[model samples]
Target: MKQRPWINVIATEPEEIINTIDKCPSGAIRYSIPEGSKIKENVSNGVGNINFENTNLSVVKIKVNANGPLLIEGPTIIIDFEGKPLKEGSKMALCRCGLSGNRHFCDGAHSKQSWKPDQIDK
Candidate 1:
C-alpha cells in the first residue's frame, strides 16, 4: 500500500521549524514544544485570549505576490459579500486569479493558469 504523505522536520534548531510553521497562511501547520524545552511558546493566554490591544499590531498590510495570491499580514477577519465573517487569522493568502477551488483562500490555483501580472487583458 502507498503511504500517505507527511512532513517529518529534522532540524538542529527548534526555531527553524517553528518559524516556518508560523508562516503557514492557512493555519494547517502546527507545532507543540515538549515540557522543559528552552524554546518559548508563542501562543495565546491560558484562557485563549490574544492580547492584541497592548501590542503594536494595529496596522494591516496586503502584499501582491508575483503571479499569485494576495498575501495579507497582521490581524484580520475575512468577510463575504453580505458582511458575514468567513475566516480570521494573522496571515492569509487570498485568491486573485479566481481559479482557486477554495474560493476566497488561495489553494495555489494561480500557478496552473496562464495569467501574468503584466498582461492587461484576461
Candidate 2:
C-alpha cells in the first residue's frame, strides 16, 4: 500500500484552516477519524497553516497524535467558536480526548483515561 501524506494545520484562525480544506483539489480529501475506529490510511490534515504560507508571517506546524491532542509548535493564535481569539502561544496541545477540563486544550486526560488509537499496520 502507498503511504498517504498527512497535513496538520495550526492557526489562530480556524476559519483559515477550514477554508483551505474547502478549497482542496478535486481528489483531495480530509478525514476526522474517531479515536477507537480503524485507521485505513496513514494520513492527517494539511501539515501547515495556509494563512502563514501565503504571507510573510511564520507558519504554525502541528502533529496529530493518535487518540490524543494535537501537538503544535511555532507562534499560534487560538480562537473560540465565536471568532474570538482565546489564546496565543509558541506551543500547545489541543484537546482531542474531549475530557479536558478546559475545552479545546489538552489537560492530560488521555493519559488518565488510557486512550489509544486504532492504528493501521505499516
Q: Which candidate is the best by lDDT?
A: 1
All candidates' lDDT scores?
A: 0.64, 0.54
- Give the distance in Å from residue 64's predicted Cα in candidate 1 to where it truly belongs: 0.9
* lDDT tens readout by residue for model 1, 19-41: 66665654434566666778665
Q: Give the root-mean-square deviation of each candidate in angstroms.
A: 5.5, 16.9
Q: Give the TM-score of candidate 2.
A: 0.46
lDDT at residue 8 of model 1 (Cα atoms): 47
lDDT value, candidate 1, whole model: 0.64
lDDT computed for candidate 2: 0.54
List pairs with backbone clashes in candidate 1.
none
